[model samples]
Target: MLLACSGVLAAPTSVSAVSADGGSRITQVKVYPGSATVERTARVPAGARSLTIRCLSPQLDVQSLQVQADAHVRIGESSVKVQDRDLDKECATPLDDQVRDAEDRVASAKAETDSLELATSYLRTVATVPPSEPHSGPGTPGSASINGTTDTLRRSSQDLLLKLHQSKRRQEAAELALKELTEERNRIAGPKARTSTVTITLASDREGELRLSYQLRGPGWSPSYRAALDSTSGVVKFERLALVAQNTGEDWRNVQLALSTGQPTRSTAGRLPGPWTINVAPAEQFTTEIRAMPAPAPVAASKVTLMSMGDRGAETTPAMPNFDVQVSDDAYATEFTVPQRITVPSGGQRITLSLGSLDARAQLVSRTSPGVEPAAYLIAQLSALPGVWPAAPVALYRDGAYVGQGRLDNNSDELSRTGLSFGRDERVVVTAEPQQQNSGSAGFTGANVERKVQHAYRVESRHQRPIALQVLDAAPVSQNEQIDVVSQYDPLPADKAWNRRPGLILWSETLAPGSSLRFTAAHTLRYPKDARLQESK
Candidate 1:
């Protein structure tokens, strides 16, 4: 018995669809400084032999496209082709519809205007034409009839002319609308499409999922931070955030996003050492000529010049921590994985994502340089974290109130601490005064000239609580061997040569409420009468 199935079986054919469909989604994104790697997963139907991923962003790096599938599936050759027609089709639909609608309105308006023009012409001709027969006496019926016809024609012509003007105005308005619509369509659709197609062939015994990933340009992210310091608790809440933006021509909807510190655009290979050569210059002998200098009387010393240093109250407690990303550290880079799926639309708008927060130990102190500014600023000494923190703008807060902004310097590998100034502390008052400057000859045979200057500073703390204050001052540093410089401080400074800067000193003290402190710095310079110091000023 020969039995056949009623319905004929059809051969399997390749199916193509834009990756924007529900079957495909951005699974992971690794963003660098100027570009990003996007991974997408697409579901393939069973018994499918081939599939085409359509409408990929033209900005995608074709060489970086990669594909993977289940073990049972045999992946075949993949290709990328620019689909110019597809782009035109994608952008033409709505714009074409609008243009067509506007054109139709314009046509209708022109037709109405033409009809009014014809009616006006007919009435004008009738009013201007002579009577068909010679008029009899004025009181005759024929003359009266002709006169009535002429009056009717004149009134109708005026009415038609008014309508003609109205119709012309309507037609002009419709034409203007059509022109605007055409310009808009041209702006949106452009001359050509910027889209491509990525086709991959696969042979699978059973159904399996496929994933395609590619690196694309025009997407990037940068790190930003918010540092809130609670002076009472001596803790600084440091929050890491990311400002991510993309203009990849396609929206990333409900996708897992990741930010990486590694710059893929940089060279991956280790730099090879180049040849080094050294050359020496020939030596030349020089002769010096000396002339007798006139002996002059000692001049009166000038007044000591005091060097001037080169230069929000809100009570909103930040809501409890709501960090929504996880951080992973690899050998070469740090990755921040967003915990929830997010939608980042195309265009260059930035989406801020909270990476994490940490409470770092911080010491609060008031700092002042009376020679530069009399006001004292609230400063914080923050301990460094394990990972490298890229230099970024830090928003500062003190005691749950907005204070100011500071910068975190993470440019050095050996940086273990950061000092940030919140804002000026008006409660502490400081004043500096220069006392005396004396210059005269000293040493054996009066060969050396001595210059001495004195300065004094007083600081008063009016805060209700005890506060730590640091005062900074600088003394002249002699760069010449003939010039000898020495300094005397009334109260020993906490740090001499602060931050490895010569002649910089810091005086630290703890002041009780309504307490005052005084300090004095005396600088003495001795040099030969004929020699001048390079950096004496």
Candidate 2:
């Protein structure tokens, strides 16, 4: 006897044969990837009865698919479920295949419409250029006989001018088309592709050890994994989650995937080395949870004391915490003096070593100093400079090897100690000496410089207040190869544009005693690249 089997039915091509295992004939089956999703409808024939559906893909193991007799359907497994109220009504529509064709045509129409709009805009702008006035008056000429000759010349000039204007109009039209295509491509491609959001969350469990939970979610679906933290040290943990795709389209087999903590929107400017592990979690839903483990007794921080020694070999000044010292320039030769017998707490503790103000000088003596000129040996000199060789760099060391940089100053006010490595003897030494700078004489040199091109450069004072620097680049840049200027330095406002000033390529700056500032500016060049290399005559 024929029995009603919900909405499932057999296709009309063949008759159902009785099987030895007493089972109804199986028909259509489809699979999707773990990363795909579906929202619309699939049609079921009227005669089909008793539909048996199963999700077999290992990547996306489906829990269940709920089929309704009339007006509704729900899809998902027992663990995850989504019920659709209008699924039955949507499925009843005829599948003529013409609807898909219509969608494509509509998309094409929109593209053509946008292209036409851009062409119209460019034509309107080109029409607005004022036409050249016709030169009409008594021609200044030799005589009636010369008039014939001049008339021929005037006709040829007018024709050439008209052609040039037409070429420009065509060029403008081409540029507009290119811009419109680029905009449409970006709109279709959507936002830039980026890494998927995968997060591991930590939590404390009833046991002494830490527990972990992992959550992964993107466009299609979300899946989670759970694991426990490491024993003894309850802070660190690891976990993995295997999520089969729920609604990936057919042909969902092998694929490539990975997880990462991408750069967040608000990243701090200056931070310590090692990975940027944020103290707080952003808007992320993890599939896994991690718990804290029992922590061991805390260790003390490392410390070193600085003691002043007198010529008699006895300690003159009281010992104080030895902080790490950094330099304004690492290339500069330096020396660090460390004293023995410093106080440390019972547990392991960390401390910093700092270098105070010291006298330093640079000299240009003959590689083999000739006894002739001592004054000539004085190349340049500075005295009583504080802090490390490199300005505002952190001091760090590990296994007697310098590791990474840390904050050099606490704030703008005073130098601060950058925390040391906890359970190791990491020490840094500085050797004091003078560092030579690359010095040169300024001269206007180079070839692309033309007599017509503007040439300029700026030179400034080191420490004094507002000093004027002159702009020198003014000649046509073709033959002259270099631009040079000499003057004192001064700080300028950030928002203001300095390069726009006539014949200027650089700005000057000045800093007071122990104070410093930095600025960046953009320059606008008036000449073409062929003239850039020309030096000022």
Candidate 3:
């Protein structure tokens, strides 16, 4: 049924509905990752016998449909029906407009073709007129005059022929488009009506509101964010947004929307251990949840000078792009309530709306993996986050300049902090010195093979102010008991096995303008000469 034209049903229809029936509109929607729960409220006068909510999406889950009324009003059994709209002619559908558009194009193209053909025919007739006796005098039409007239007719005929050909081609294209649209309609409509209706038996003592709620399949939302940083103030303003869309056949106008983390559409029952004999394994053994790659370590380094905080330097706190919203954190879900009523149309277009805004001091730091790349990256760290910041895309602004985009992955065991890299800082250059490696026999009897690797890295800063830089490198970890790995760092690293990740060395230092620090790490691995030891990438 006319998805393009489908609107809120003015009045719900029911066979036994009384005059007490009233208009119903979707008042609230709780949108999850893949589905949404829709709640529609209808107010009826006293002594109402039944209520019906009409024009529901065919994608709704019938088993989850429920109806309730005020305590005084009793809601009885409700039934969902997929009824066919029996009409003398085709009920209006979304494809009808497209079909008519194609028809108009075809008719216009055919008309143009007909006019061009007529003009071409007249020109052909004039140009093909048999050459009569040529008079060899002026004003009597000599060969030159005949030639010019012939040329004009030939040019006109050719132009008209080209026009006719183009018009025919357009006409064919329009006809084909019409055919495809018609076929699509026939296939989707499938000789049946797609409208839906829900009827609930109710007995009301006084004027009360009847709430009908159901789960729909094709409506969901995702989070988006825009963060602006003021370097002088170390303050960051965040504008939180949600991209919401629905293909549920009816427009949700003036609805109270809540973005929810709850997954009601998913199963709550824990998976029980199935009968498993080692020989006869269960069809589905186990499941693994692949977490998103964490954001770079919470390193806070600012491009602006540390002593410049008092100046403000034309960098007033950025105005936060925001909306009125309320956040509710329950045990099962954290929901953000959109304060104002919003409308999400049913054409599957993502409508962006603000969830709210927050202001916090951003901790900035520079991090570089000198072993892997020769550039240092500036990162902004946020220790305190919004009540609920899901994994989404982020647009960053630094010192009033647009930097770039980054993905926010907050699924960390440590929830107190998150970081976003603002791309590379060309001012800080990292140089990896040539590697030194050698192999030799270490045991007294030459029974042990020894491998030694020496790596040196240099990091220099070009910024006017000192920047806190952290260089990441790793020493090899051996799996075998007999394989011994020894690591030595020049001026020892600031944090060994940083963040509990074994063998990962993090070196932290403040580098001044034009100043550099050289870091050396030596790794020696010894194994029995008879055993095979392989290095991995």
Model 3 lDDT, residue 193, Cα: 45
Off by over 4 Å in 1: 1-23, 83-193, 205-207, 279-323, 386-388, 410-418
Off by over 4 Å in 2: 1-153, 176-180, 183-537
Cα distance off (Å), candidate 3, residue 293: 26
Error of 2 at 169 (Å): 4.4
Model 2 weakest lDDT span, ten residues long: 364-373
Which order, best to worst by lDDT? 3, 1, 2
**Please, what is the TM-score per model?**
0.72, 0.16, 0.72
Q: Could you tell which candidate, 1 or 3, scores higher by lDDT?
A: 3
Q: Quick one: how many clashes does candidate 2 have?
A: 103
TM-score of 3: 0.72
Report the lDDT tens digits of candidate 3 across residue range 152-183. 76676777888889889998988899889876
- How well does candidate 2 match the true structure, expressed as C-alpha RMSD? 32.0
Candidate with more favorable, higher TM-score: 1 or 2: 1
lDDT of 1 by residue, 1-537 (tens): 000001111124555322222245566767777788988777666566666666566787989999999888778888787656444443234556777898999999999999887776655554554556454454333323555654686686778888889989989999999898776544432335366667777776566778888998757777778988887788888888678877665656656667788777665665454555544544563544444445544433111101011111125643443346777898988887776566665545566777778788877889999978788998887566656577777788888888877777656522232278888999999998767899999997999999998889999999999998899988888777888889999899988888777788889899899999998999999999988556633
Quote the positional error of residue 76 for candidate 2 in Å.
Answer: 10
